[model samples]
Target: MSEISNNFLYEAIDEDIASGKVKADEIHTRFPPEPNGYLHIGHCKAMIIDFGTARKYGGKCNLRMDDTNPAKEDTEYVDAIKEDIKWLGFDWEDRFYYGSDYFEKDYELAVGLIKKGLAYVCELTPEQFRTPEYAGNTTTPAVSPWRDRPIEESLDLFERMKNGEFPEGKYTLRAKIDLASGNFCMRDPVIYRIKYVEHHRQGTKWCIFPMYDFAHPIQDALEGITHSLCSLEYVIHRPLYNWVIENVDLDYKPCPPRQIEFARLNMTHTVMSKRYLRALVENGVVDGWDDPRMPTLCGLRRRGYTAASILDFIERIGVSTSNSLVDIRLLESCIREELNMKAARRICVQKPLKVVIDNYPEDKVEYFSVSNNPNDPEAGTREVPFTRELYIDAEDFAEVPPPKFFRMKPDGEVRLMGAYIVKCVSIEKNEDGSVKEIHCTADLEAGNGNPLDGRKIKGTIHWLSAKYAEDTTLVLYSHLFTLENVADIPEGKTYEDYMDPNSALRIEGAKIEPALANAEAGERFQFVRSGYFVKDTKNPNTFNRIVSLKDGFKA
Candidate 1:
């Protein structure tokens, strides 16, 4: 496990404790995500901070669903969020909650603000409100004809709105804060709006929903969150959050939750936007949310990333107040480093080419001992079958070898991993001019040892007995987008313009050894000289390449 470095986020908490503003043990944080889509890699950073801080201070963090808007929210997303968090090794204990759970209190607070003359029901259409006449300038305040509606009238209209008496755009409840404040979020932002969509949890019992800006702070305070950690995009809304905390008369809680902002995670070659991801799924550009190519947590998990590796990546990147694009290779390197030490070794021949040992007995089958993981002695060893006919990756052989190529060539000698050295003596070509079979003579005296003459063999390759190999599918993945950073797409170009057409390549009928047929879904293994792969949970006889064997990232 990577240790958490001392960053400004922790420094702020330290200062709070030093100043007696908040006790170290009183630290409380919340990860409130809108359960409208699957959680992606960007959410992982926030999740770490939320849970890591609580663990650091012996405090508690709550997992709350910011499901104020019911349009896209669903119990499916809610369940997925919890599963992803737990899979990442964080525990919320008994602190799971939903924003809609506070809907009644949100309503009561809005009404209280109206009676206090700090809020009113507005009738301006969204478009009209955005017009220059209503969108106040620095000198001119925003104009709202209903800004001064009587408290009783606003209260009655709010109740009627809740009763489904009005259309979606007919009315909105807005806080009567400054209309010309430098921070526009305080320009009487909408506290509540009419949504006819059925809430995933609340059902049709309520027709109006609270906007996130209004509902979030209240939810934080109600949950007794001492630190409301969120991405840097919400920094501008800090004033509004503080304003709500000061004005709202939630007497039950004496201390208001403090809002802290940190930069969100952005990675090269992939996007974290839920809208873009949803479009990818909807347009059939990708398989689904858990498609190994997507950046969603489930997607990464399916792609064979471990929770510890992800946490290690997060620790290496650390927390930053400024936004920057991190190299995806850094993440790949973490998984590679982890799998190199942990994943068991297996033989898989993608694009198999037959190698017939002409000198070996046709009825004989020999087993050679091979280490399951060379880096892990306790992982033990497994026996691999070697027979008269074997399958090696077609790429390992080249009839006309390129310079510096050390694999198989005509009349060349190569060592079959865990077995004897074989010399390619003859080849048979198919009608398509491709090598159909390579007839090789195995040195029987070499056996599982080496050549008796001590002649060096330049090439070594992995192979599986053709008779014992199981046909399986292998899904190879690459960058989803060709662009280094999808965020830098040209002004008029959409992400689709940079989407890689061959992001995922599926190879069917790939030959895997009999040992691999017993691999359970999600079990990871290193394909000798190929890459790391994991069995697909939703597919039969299929594996997904987690990452290639090499990356330039040093850490």
Candidate 2:
């Protein structure tokens, strides 16, 4: 766990330590995510920073569930978020917390604000409350009519709000910051909104919930977090994050936690919003959160991405200040680098074309030794069964060959991967004039490493013997969206308009090596000429395409 790059945030941390505003070995942080949906890759950057920063400074980081909004919160999301964080190698130990757990204390904090007259209950409708107005050539917030309500009346209403006597949105507690302030968040932002929905953790004890901007800072300081780390989108909310911590009566030891922002991950070809992601699932545009084409962590994991590879990606794309779009190819490149060294080599022919070794082996069967991984010596070799009938990829052969095409055609000579050189004799056609099968003769003198025939074989193709092959399903995946930055859609059209209709394709009756029959979940392999693949956890004898072999990223 090397320290994250020394950027503006870390520089600020340095100053905090040098000036003694922050003590030595006290740089605590937290990865506080709302329990709403599955964590996406963008969340990984936050995970790396919070956990990595704490480890760097000899401090601790807490894992907190910001389960304030009871309407959409669920224990399932909490569990999934924890699983994703743990999978990235962060352990919060005993510091797991939820913002709703502080409901009583938050109410008491509001009580203190009410006593100091720093906060008041408001009855403004959302339109009236958030309406923008111009005053003296400057943007001004429309002040709530209830802003000047008597202190006792506001306190009683807030108490009543807690007792579930008020309908949702009938009342809310607003921090009494300046309405004329330039920052919109400081314009008497609502900190507590009435929500009648049941909380995943808190149950029916409380009807009012804390806003994220209000609850997060309180949770951070309560946990004694030194640096409140978050994405750059919260830069505007940082002022409010500080405001809550400053005004709230707390027992924090050193000082209130400091909020720092860095650029959030934005990438091409995928949408990050939970609303849209859920739509994709509900609309059946995607299978679920774990669909190989999805950008969710579970989806990536199921798509054969390794935890180490994801961490490596975080390292490759260091933390920064300004938000920018990163090419998704970089992500694919990172996983490719990892699987290139770790994934074992195997042979599987999709869209199989029948090949018969006409002259040499009509009734004979032989085993040819193939290297498990040419890049890894310790991987050794495995015996590949060779029989009279075998299946190669249809794409590896050409009825009317393209320019300089070196693979099998009429009278064309090519190597049979790790086996022997083969020369195509003739082809058989179907009613549609498509080549249904190919006839070839294996050159017995051109066996593996013992080639007596001196003619050079330029192209080599992978194949599986029909006698020993296993029927498998091959899943091919493409980008989920057809356009980059799916967030910026054509005005009137929905996100489904840009979705790639053929993102996930299933091809049954694929030919794979018999050894793959015993492969367990998460076992990865390179399908010879094809891309890396992993066995699907939910479907037996099915493999999900992890990534294509195209290395799009520059070294």
Candidate 3:
């Protein structure tokens, strides 16, 4: 929605509607997710495309839960998914659905398939079915001995299976496709399995659950979905998808819903696998699903990533069929661009070093005016306390100046941002030989527009009045993985092997200007030259650095 250019996905939808392949009234789409885990960034990309496409075409989008595996599915995940979708600025508007809601209809459809001799009851256990000897090549699918059973017996067994007559995994309803088809999915894939576990949504209403391949196409058709878009992995499954629709007798066109595949989003330095992410949580490697290092939407939100920024990121990435690893810097760039125009400018020193103005009166305190945002004049300005004692970043003062370092050093003169120019006179060292503090003398005569102030200083540094500055905590976050291509690790090593141990650093004893004392949670600001940061919701006083200001001079 933020001034995005035309892409193939949009062009295809437009062409379809213009060519009468799809009518405006029939342009419904749905984002079908399995409610087994938290939605990640990859899922976010799909949701934006799914809902964005529908909305642009004056169609409605449905949020459907593919709650087929009750053992791993739960209402917690269902609720989280909905909350995330809403947070991403999308709404399904009462078009919410669940695959479990069609249990009765799915059962009847399975029964019809049995009556048509296109499906049968297979007694093979999962272990035996997975064996190399049992699972032959696509040219020679190992025939199931039970496939020859009569339709009446198959139908009866399927009913008994649903009624809990047999234990879980004893029998399964499989499509009676070719035994020697080129496509492996067409070689008698499993359509239904007997699972005695209670469903999160339906409770104990049914024991037989439809597989994704069996339920997805039917649900799309039932919801009148015109564009059944999915990732490229489903390309091989399309034949079977159409087979089910064609075989099922329906009042409307059986194959009106078409499935299209696009390459999924993959980013460098981050693992998108939900299973691995869950392992990180379960093993205590990270805090939880919302850990700042995670790629989950909740994690991004907690890390001060605005929904608008994420939407902008998705827009920049666009839709593509070819796969590529997007640099994480691009995401950071998008966030920086958004925050620069919106976030207020403030001052906070992560590592504080005491600076004493020797010549200034110790009891005196004055207010220095500073602009809230230089980009917008109407943003106004606020006054910050200036006193004899102040705290500057420890790195700002170099005991021995490095080459090209323009910051404070012995005998160096610098402007104390918004205050008078000061020249360092001497350094005080502790017993440990560490520079404890730096003493400077402010040139009071060189006030604003003074004749002597015509001279320029190469360095200008931000500081907070030591007397009025508040002590607070600050969190600095970095990339989760050390390596760019986490998936390309050594054979035995996993993506976790490349996890960065210093991805998050919590710093205490940080000092902020008195103006930031009233900063509330969810408020974002550019912390002077430090970086763009936001107040943590969990701890209002604590600020988390989102991204640093770009240093164009850096190679």
Candidate 4:
């Protein structure tokens, strides 16, 4: 928190508090997400700001479900959202609310607008009033035909609409704001629309539902949210937001909520839209919303990302009003930074090749001392079992060495990490000409720094004793898309056209050190030379690579 030096939202709030527009000790904020889909990585940014800002000011934040359109909402999403927020370490206390909880208040406010002649029933169809009025800041005003409907008649219609008298789309209550204004949102925007569909929470009790623009301000006003933080797309809607608060008669709040906009997080290789993500799930392009390749919070969590790591990423990105694309590597850097300190060091040869120590007695088994975490002396050490036969990654050997290639070629010497230096004697091949086994002889006294072991082995590799290794699987993940921005595809080609074919690569029967056989679910480890990985929650003996040991994405 001390590292964050400049934030416009905080600056704005300080000025508001100074001006006495907001109470010094009563500062409140809210995260009003519609219960339509699972919260993604982008929503994490908003959550931190809304929850963090209130916390910073020694106040509270509310978790409000702005569920006006129940057509797309469900209790499933509501529960999931709450879980996600709590998982990220934020609390709303007893301030949890739904927009429908204030339906009575919203309806009364709408009636007040009607009584003031500020709102009227609109008879024009969505098509008739669908003029591109907001485009280029100069669209001709296309007023609704029922703009001047008599107060008595419109009030009766509105009441009947609430009583389920009108069918869907027969009439809409629109705010009678400027018709010729440059901003189309202020140009008589619809405040309420009649929908016969059943609400997830309200059921069939409400046939006429308040639009988002109408419900949001009322919700904020009722909750006394001093600062309404949102993404930059809501910047143009600020005036409309204030207009609703100004026109509505509400006594819950002495001051309207201050609307502040900041840039949203956008990454290079992932799409942030729920609709697109849903398509991927429904089409079986990905396993589910929690698929590791997905950018959703659940997906990242399942992919072995720590909550602290995500928070670190958010802090590094900072908050701004200007939109920009963040390099995905920074996100990876967050994971790498956090995991390096805690993830225990282990030896796991992903693609194992049998290496037999021909000079060692077959009945002998030795345990070697290795530091668990070199940076933390208190972490101490553990003994890894070593046997006459062991397994190393197949890539560590080359039958015909390339120029300057060092690791275990025939008759080449190398150091076995945490064990003795060994010299390869011969290579065995299969009928298909593939190398089957590597035969080696270890310098027995080398690991203890004996005088006979004086050598600089440039090729040091990790290994696991075949006898003490557990048969495991490693599930590696790559970017979901091949293109830098899926939106940059050629004409007629959809975002799925760039779906990465190698997004997930699974290796079976991989050998992991026996000590990890019972590693708890969600436990993380650094596969010595490979990467950071976590034990899969659903699949036993299966692990998911959180990230490579180093950054691979440059741009």
Q: Compute each candidate's TM-score over C-alphas.
A: 0.97, 0.97, 0.96, 0.96
- Give the alpha carbon lDDT tens digit for every residue of 1-555 in model 4: 312236988899899989988776788889988888889999998999888888888888999998998788999889989999988899999999999999898888899899999999887666666545322236566556688899988899999989998778889999988888887778888999999888998899999999988889888988888889889988878899999878787764647787899999888898998989989989999888889999988899889998888888889899998988888889999889888888888888989999999988899999999888886788888999889999999999988889999898988898888787889998889999998899999887665454273567888889999888989999999999988866567988989788888889999989999779889988999989999999988888899999999876552
Q: Which runs of model 1 end up more than 4 angstroms from their true locations?
A: 1-3, 252-254
Top candidate on lDDT is 1
Q: Pick the candidate with the highest TM-score.
A: 1
Which residue ranges in model 4 land beyond 4 Å of their true spot? 1-5, 131-139, 252-254, 447-453, 552-555
For candidate 2, which ten residues in a row score worst on lDDT?
133-142
What ranking of all candidate models by lDDT puts the best one first? Answer: 1, 4, 3, 2
Q: Report model 1's TM-score to 2 decimal places.
A: 0.97
Clashing pairs in 1: none
Q: Against the correct fold, how does model 3 do in TM-score?
A: 0.96
| Model 3 misplacement above 4 A | 2-5, 253-255, 448-453, 551-555
Candidate 3 C-alpha lDDT tens digits along 1-555:
632357777777778778878777667889998898889888988898889878877888999999977988989899999999999889999999999887888889889999999999999899988876777875556768898999999999999998889988999999998867888888799999988888998898888899989988888888888888888889999999999888876544322787887788888898888888889889998778887778999888888898898888888888888778888788888889888888889999999999999999999989888999998788899999889999999989998889978889888888888887888999999999998988999889885333283776888889999999998999899988898877778888876678888888999999998878888887889999999998887876899888888834210
- RMSD, every candidate, angstroms: 1.5, 1.7, 2.0, 2.0
Tens-digit lDDT track for model 2 on 1-555? Answer: 445676677788889999988875888999888788899898888888989888888888898888888888899999999899888888999988888778888888888998899999998866655445321114545467777888999999999998889888799899998877888788888989887777777778888888888888888878888998888889999888888888888978676799999999888998888888888788887879888888899989999898888888878888898988888888889989888987899999999999998976578889988889889999999999999999999999997899999999889988898888889999889999999899998888657654574667788899999899999999999898898877778889877788777888899999999889899998999989999999998888899998987775684
Worst 10 residues of 1 by lDDT: 248-257
Q: How high is the CA lDDT of each candidate model?
A: 0.91, 0.85, 0.86, 0.86
Task: Estimate candidate 3's RMSD in Å.
Answer: 2.0
Q: In model 4, what is the error at residue 401, expressed in angstroms?
A: 1.4
